[model samples]
Target chain A: MSHNTEVLDQKTLWGGGRSPFNVSYGKLMIWFFLISDALTFSGLLCSYGFMRHKFSDTWPSANDVFVHFPFMGDAHVPLLYVGLMTFILILSSVTMVLAVEAGHRRNKKEVQIWLALTIVGGFFFLFSQVWEWAHFIHGTEAGAIKDIIVDGEWVTQVVHGANLHHNEYGNVLFGDFFFFITGFHGFHVFSGVVINIIILIKVMKGHMDKTGHYEMVEKTGLYWHFVDLVWVFVFTFFYLV
Target chain B: MERDDIIEYSLDISHTDEEGKVIRKRLWKVFWILLAVTIFEVGMGFMFAGVAAYKDMLMYTFIFLTVVKAGYIVMIFMHLGDEMSYLKKIILIPYCFFIAYLLFIAISEANFIFDIGWVLG
Candidate 1:
């Protein structure tokens, strides 16, 4: 513990006390937290693979599991919708970088405007996620449903909601893990939006330039980008893989 | 503090233009690199997507590329690359270990549970 304390104490003054590693306290913590959180996510995805290997025969494919959009009422596009989501997220990350750049130039208005745009992008991403979850839960009327007994209660499940065989995308465990992983990731993006909002608020109120610091913005940019990075993995593993 | 040394915390990074539109040249270069990398990823995604050969291998390769691209964006674009290599190593090497450890434990435990379900139940 003493050694640990010493390590932290030594690092507490990094970046000549100006940078403190890219941004400030909020973002620094977010990065460290995200690294560990990212590890957790990697673990979850790794388990997904293990389970997939065991169920190689009957296990549903990713393309079949998430085929259609909710309320679209027509058409099955395998990667089309997810590809769009990826586009939105990547664009938002670009805007976040722009916001950080604007801050670096000391252009408050530009920074504020860019931040607002990023927030809009974040909200759009969240809305899409909500729809995805809703589709996962309720499924479509066209697909076959399953009844499984849980604790003396009968529960309904979607069996191949995306395909003709009507094989459940996963067993109860499948549904459980899917919800756990994706939902957790979505929550991170949601919380990130919340943080961006707070940062935007602080910028608008003129708090950053006062102390001769926009490390806050820089740090937040790191976090926002990290969120985007994790999604790339999610896309590859959950969708593309 | 001297004017030059006094870090203006304001949003104004402009040293030349009156409107404060100035930006570092490196930002554009980084943006272009990121875009190029994204295009490559999309290409790989489409290419391997239809073919069944080495699906796992392709996915792992893409993941490795993503990690590389993300690290570059953080290091070069974000200027962590400019810092002493020692510091960069300090931050990154441990996180790699953690990811591996988490991957092993989580996957093995999950498989273990699934196995027990089959044998005992």
Candidate 2:
């Protein structure tokens, strides 16, 4: 019994009782979940790349498509609004990491402040996405005229905006992909805001303090950072590329 | 199996002022790097507009810069850099392989379809 107790004492830190990766169970699970989620996103992006490559000649340039800024009033500025959106998301990511850092210090006030900032950033990004999507669906004033067969008769029609079946943009797949990817990413940001709000409430209630740890905030930070990371890819592939 | 035992073992909080400063510095550095890369990407996008000859080059550059940005976000912001080296490898290696394989298949298959003129012709 004495020998066994001595071995246990020496191996306490490395024992099976602790995580092999030095991460808590919740954190490890979050990492794994993020990895799987990344694969799903990559799958979508790859399919988009394939379709874009296949329609290279007729692929609508993103610059020409996403050129509206709020209150800019028909002044064509390409990539500017999306650039602002990217800045917002990246800034939010910084604030989120700062929150995690403050949590590590057990500074409830700092954590709450940073978390609130993150939620605000997330709301801004989500609203921006809504505005961008509305512009995409509304399209430009001139629109595009295409001949389509209706009831066995070829008829010429003007299509102003985008839908699932047709787009004033060059290719139909362009609108589809845009809606799918950005809508999906927007959904993620919304969920992230909800999660951040929950975490903030918990912080306000001193739940983390009661537990004597702030690991929950860290887990939510991981998730928020993942959302930001996905936006980085989407901005590159969908807008810039 | 007590809650205190779990907290004591699992918490990796930095208690030192110097350590906190170091972490904050690193985080801000990463933020600056991400910002610079994004601005560079937007600038290049503007410069490459209507320049058909440089389309391929622009695409490649954007991809490269994006990968760099992703690296910073994943490593620093996600705290992967502070994890065990083996843990880092386990998370990153599979993603590297999966992305490469998917890109290869996507590019080659799309090229083949385009060459055949199956849809466009």
Candidate 3:
């Protein structure tokens, strides 16, 4: 991928020197912002890992635990439903890409259409998550995973009311963190979708075209892509392998 | 270094000139590379699943590959790579450090829980 200038490019990346080329201060600031944001997400995920490791022997298998809807009114099925949700999220990411394309061309109508699609996709994902949370909270109790050991390693072999309610899966800590982390992430996506929709409305009014800049679309696209990227990891770590 | 190169790099497929006229470039080359890498990823995901040498190790490899794909999209597709190297490093270092630190704690905490052996045998 390197051309004649590859060696020179390396001087910046390596050789203990700053960049040979100049970039804007805005772009550099954005980089720093993304860096901090990335750290926040990493910290949350890492905590999950710690808890997962502690429960390794009796840890719930993602597939098995996620199987069966809790409030399905006595239905029996597994995995297919969540798979559909994943498909929805990924497809929405594609639509966002289309919107980015349209924005580049100053295709206002096209941008609106694509943004609408992406917003719909976002809503669909959120709905799926809510359903999943309900099932997680009040659905079929997990099989492979049973009982909870407190932070001090005291196993509480008790089951009453719901899974996390009485003490089925483990102590309430898992449930607490689950709601907090996923809920926080979900809230972010929810807000991001709102912002995009607002921009879509503005684009329909021709604000971006009149201003001769589509930086809004570009910045929002970055945020959307990051959300999708985070979910890709969450899907693997939280749901699948 | 040409206009088309800049355009081609910014947009995935082709680009236009100053007058908004289409400028056909050999953009398919980049597409081919991306596709080839994606195929390798799919192959690795499936192949490594069965190796069982160390499940965690394979999982990390998969994560690494996924990061590579993401990096390509940002650097090539999003034009981030063309920016100043200082900018790129600043953004990437924090991101990597954040993710790494979180994952470290995740594994450590999970390990501590497993040692309890209170839930599963």
Q: Which candidate is the best by TM-score?
A: 2
Q: What tens digits encode model 2's per-residue C-alpha lDDT throughout A1-241?
A: 0012222344464566655566667878999999999999999999999999898888899999998888999998899899999999999999999999888888899999999999999999999999999999999889999665568887889988787866898888899999999999899999999999999999999899888888888889999999999999999999998
Kindly give the stretch of ten consecutive residues in candidate 2 chain A with the minimal lDDT sum. A1-10
Candidate 2 Cα outliers beyond 4 Å, as residue runs? A1-15, A147-155, B1-8
True contacts kept of 1: 0.19
Rank all candidate structures by their TM-score, best first, as comma-separated numbers.
2, 1, 3
Classify candidate 1 by CAPRI docking class: acceptable
Task: Encode model 1's per-residue lDDT on A59-91: one tens digit a residue.
Answer: 555666676765677576566667667778877
lDDT of residue A22 for candidate 1: 33
Predicted candidate 3 versus true structure: per-residue lDDT over A11-78, tens digit per residue: 35444333233432343455556556656777777777776667555444444445565456556444
Better of 1 and 2 by TM-score: 2
lDDT of 1 at A231: 82
Best of the candidates, lDDT? 2
Clash pairs detected, candidate 2: none
**Local accuracy by lDDT, each model:** 0.67, 0.87, 0.60
Could you tell me every candidate's TM-score relative to the true structure? 0.75, 0.92, 0.69
Q: What ordering of candidates by lDDT runs from best to worst?
A: 2, 1, 3
TM-score of 1: 0.75
Better of 1 and 3 by TM-score: 1
